[model samples]
Target: MAWPTGASPYGIGVRDAVVRGVGPRSTDGVIRVWYPAHVPSSLAARRYFDGPDELQIMTRGLGWLLSARGVRALGGWRTRGHTNAPPAAGRLPVVFFSHGFTGFVGQNTHLCERLAAAGYLVISIAYPEAAASICAPDGSSNVMSAAQRRRLVGDQFARAMVRLLRARSIDAENRAISEVTAVDTLARENDRWSVHLTAMLDALVPIDQRRARVDTATAAILDAGDWSRVALMGMSFGGSTSANVAHLDERARAAINLDGMQQGDILLGQDIRVPLLVMSSAGSMLPSGRVVNDLHYESRRTATGRVQRVLVADAGHYAFSDLVAFGARRTRGLLDLGTVDPERMLTLVADTVTAFLGDALEPGGDSGTDETEVSP
Candidate 1:
């Protein structure tokens, strides 16, 4: 689906590149970057999880038992800037992006690209730890958890996701979801990803800290001298991590959770001094989803700065993903990307994200940049 770039004074250009030093997975895990690229070469967008015989993998993998194809790139690859492209005139806000469980760094490119266009340097990290698998640039892929696959596999599971996502009866949906037990799964993964916030910040910011193995070559590409303008954002499981991590990490200026359910430490209680934006699918914001998210939002609202919650009407758990637009509309794949007007949802999600980030990071910027600015 085509997402819009708002009429900001800054013209938007994009380039996707990779960085390592986070973990030991040369292809196991890598950080993906979507920065402002004024002039980029037209390189064909390549697939990290789609092909079996390619040379290397630049991202994470999400799929069912049969297919491992990550969301296929539908020709926005021109954003891949040449190595060491110039940063926009000034130091832009640095946004740390974490994708949902079993999702690639590019899983939420629609949002990342939009944020980049709005003058933010968005970086996403994908690892095989919480994902089904990660692939090498040589096209050789490996599975991280056969157990995760078993838990998510089968016609029964797909129907469960579809029912929980598309069910008319909220009670039935809640029961089905409870039976599945993915919330615990999500929370654990969120914790795994969240703990890395300090490490991620250590690498991105110019501060001297004992860091993960710094990917010196890739680190050179980053120009983030301003540690004050940092934010954490993620979708689904990633969203949960953003919320929990924002509470745990002192450096996060703000955090946004896009339709991710709260569990684990967030439920036990966490501190929050950072502004948080929690967005949910209108449909799934009920029963357990609402119960957890509302409590988290309200608690954080009291503990810290602003905690804004908005619902994307006519959307589902997967609405924040590109799967709905690029992948098949139906629940044909491993993920039940429910049917929504992909274009409309993308527009709504992107607009809300841009506004929220602007309000939180920009000095003298009003919080009116939120969903209130975007007509329902």
Candidate 2:
């Protein structure tokens, strides 16, 4: 596997730890932090997951087809970051990241590393129940159970997708989106995830009482984070969660969604209070100049803060993920990794996101809707 290129003035340091559960409904989950650090010359880059954990996660679902040898080979991949290196001093802006459904915390470590190198504190959260594979601080591993998969994608989901894709009119499309959001099981699950994200934000912000729950090292890192200037970002279902959390949480300064359709409250008439940047894969939009699988239509109907939409040409849904670089050519082709060169795709996404965050986090604030297309 190839390491994704990142441009940064600061050396990156990463740490894996558990974030104590907040509130009555929340449960402990694994979290990895990538931040500017004082890496010594003698330190070495760390393996992707450092052990067999990667194989356990990668060898499920369609990934079951991957040979154990191939999966082990992937484990040999190294990250640019060193483990638990000394964090750089000073308060830095923070970005909270959530992974896609069935995705682990490391799904987009390249992006987290890039953001960290650029001098931000990046925290990636992993939900044990929702993730394909995740490990707690004590070394217990959790993989999504078979029953969980069936419940997540069973009959209710199939019917929703069919109605969502077949809607011919704007009203019909909105109606279909509403029905999908109304599904009790799915909606409850989305709410639970959103609460999980909120709990993370609560742990970071100094004013929140939950800060005491984090470990000493993590608390020190949090102490150096400018939580007042926070951003929420994620991919797929995680992206949708970011939008929802940003809408409800006044602490979030901005939100970014990578190739995910907005659902739940976001599609049901709630407006995101903070700025939102929705980066879509080429397939999400039609040549007719409309986004079919996203809240592009719904967002236009509901007034909100600045919303910028970017359509990446020659890209597929998974292009926004590390799979574009990690998977073999044949594997990528089978997974719809699109025609965009993997390196170029990473560069494009990182640069675009960094630029957007810079503007969105500016003091005075920004508003309005802007849509553009980029070919990498």
Candidate 3:
């Protein structure tokens, strides 16, 4: 399989493995895996979205959140993907991924596939109910509604949380969530993410070599992954989940947040135990935009563990996504996707993410992230 030019540094292959997450919220969803493929691509390339409807929903939903004028209509849309191919030889570094609020697992395919091309096994989980829509392997769809969302978080204030996401100022958003709901939301999502991390680990055991938990397709790629050496990463709400999981589980070698807002107890004086990299978008540096990033940086400002906060130039919240290049940007300047070139931004993000994970997961790569600095 082949990846886009700027998406990765190497050629990669992808496969879809269905794993039934065992625990409180046992979900049956697709875990998209991207790996370094030595085998040639004999089959057709994979579809980027589960279906055209999913693509439309993602494009429009993100537009509504990031674009004041809302997402422009989709005309001709295309995606870059190579899926369900044979696994590459040799076990590779494993990295787990999470999506943003009201976003699906496949929302950040470019980032996940880019890591795969860089010789890392990348897994992006399609969140059930939490996402606006989740596509299962059996050709069905699951969409989360506002009423359902509040239940997922075990709260009655789902509308308030949604309103907060649309708030123009950080102060407004901060004020939207009271101390009680803040803790409740964080604790619930943290438990959900923790369960996901543990379930992924459990799925790593070989089917014939162990008990029956994951499907055969998942078992095929499990042997080639190093469970001992794993990393947790996410975009948007997934970032909070990744941070929370990395904090609780020592197995997470590194944690990277791609323009994700911090969540849960971390806002209430919780320290991240593992190494963390906060890659903020250009807009995040703005006075009004700094609301979420400010809290994240403050949480680790006085900590002792390795934490590097780098601000990317000419980027916005959606820059971490493929929408910048793929979506129809009808109302330009209305959305703060990024001021810099989309490809350039993604290349930098992909490179920096790989470097941080490499240093943390590998021996003697570069454990020093002492100073909080901005990238050029």
Best by lDDT: 2
Judging by TM-score, tell me the better candidate of 2 and 3.
Answer: 2
Computed on alpha carbons, the lDDT of every model, listed in order, comes to: 0.59, 0.75, 0.64
Q: Candidate 2's residue-wise lDDT over 1-376, tens digit each?
A: 5566665667889888776655332225578899999999998988876756545655552244346665566567787888888999977888989888777787787888888888888989986577766766666666677677566676787787678777777777767767777777778779889988987776667544435667788777767788778999999889889988887888999888998776675645445577888888877763334675455323454465478778987899888987777567787777778989988888888887887887887786663577778875
Rank ordering of all candidates by TM-score, starting from the highest: 2, 3, 1
Q: Candidate 1: misplaced stretches above 4 Å?
A: 1-3, 6-21, 40-60, 63-85, 133-142, 150-188, 207-217, 267-271, 287-291, 300-305, 327-335, 364-376
lDDT agreement of model 2 with the native: 0.75
Q: Which candidate comes out best when scored by TM-score?
A: 2
RMSD versus native structure for model 3:
5.3
Alpha-carbon lDDT of model 1: 0.59
- Can you write out model 1's per-residue Cα lDDT over 1-376, one digit (the tens) per residue? 3354455544344333333465665654456666665444453333323343321232223334224343234322333223345555657788988877666666676677677767787777765566545554444456555566454356655665666666566567656555444444444555566666556666567544313334443444355434578889998878877877777677777888888876454434344556678777754555444433554544444554477767665566776876656555434233444555777777777887787888888764424313321224
lDDT-wise, the better of 2 and 3 is 2
Better of 1 and 3 by TM-score: 3
For model 2, give the RMSD to the true fold: 2.9
C-alpha RMSD values across all candidates: 5.7, 2.9, 5.3
Pairs clashing in candidate 3? none
